[model samples]
Target: MRSRYTAYVLGLEDYLLQTWHPDFRPVSLDLAENEQIKWLGLRVNQTALTSENTASVDFIARYKIRGKAERMHELSQFELIENHWYYLTGEMK
Candidate 1:
């Protein structure tokens, strides 16, 4: 999860897509389109095991765009496949 946040901060779209579950991944993503956004930090609020190979993480991320600060709070779901974690989906708060 933290690595995914770091990928966003660095605008690493390829890494982001690679880590996402194929079923949930979009056909394409362009991080450069949001270049105006300056990521500040990410705070993991909580994590819970939902199933043997599934988990949920609640997090808050801060960013600024044109000097306007904003926060994104989300509950994300992930699945463990072949000893690797893959992002499924997220619900924004």
Candidate 2:
């Protein structure tokens, strides 16, 4: 979860895509268009293993865009496949 946050902070769209599950991965995030967004920080509230290969992370990411502050609170889901973890989906909180 932290790594993914860093990816967004750095505008590493390719890296983000690479870590996302193929079934859930979008074709593009268009991070370049969000250049004006300034990522402030990420706070991981909790994490839980739902199953042997599935887990969820509850986090909040703070940022600013056009001098306006905002935050995203999400319960992110992940799946472990072939010893690697991939982001599956997320639900806004």
Candidate 3:
């Protein structure tokens, strides 16, 4: 989750796509187009294993767009495949 946050802050779209589960990966990303977005910080609230190969992370990411502050709270799901963890989906709160 932290790595993914860093990826967003760095505009590392390819790294983000690589970490996402292939089945859930988006066709494309427009990170560079959002030039006004400024990532502030990431706060991980909790993490839990739902099963042997599945887990969830609850986090809050703070940022600013066009000089206006905002935050995103989400519970993200991930699955372990072939000993590697890949992001599956997320639910915004």
TM values, all candidates: 0.97, 0.96, 0.95
Q: For model 2, how big is the CA root-mean-square deviation? A: 0.8
lDDT of prediction 1: 0.95
| lDDT score of residue 15 within candidate 2 | 93
lDDT of 2: 0.95
Ranked by lDDT, the better of candidates 1 and 3 is 1
lDDT for 1 in candidate 3 is 88
Candidate 3 segments whose C-alpha is farther than 4 A from its true place: none
Candidate 2 local lDDT, residue 17: 98
C-alpha lDDT of residue 33 in model 2: 74
lDDT of 1 by residue, 16-93 (tens): 999999999998798877799999999999999999999999999999999999999999999999998999999999
The residue pairs that clash in candidate 1, if any, are none
Over the stretch 45-82, how does candidate 2's per-residue lDDT look in tens digits? Answer: 99999999999999999999999999999999999999
Shift of residue 20 alpha carbon in model 2, Å = 0.5
Best candidate per TM-score, number?
Answer: 1
Quote the positional error of residue 36 for candidate 3 in Å: 1.1
True lDDT of residue 30, candidate 2: 90
lDDT of 3 at 45: 99
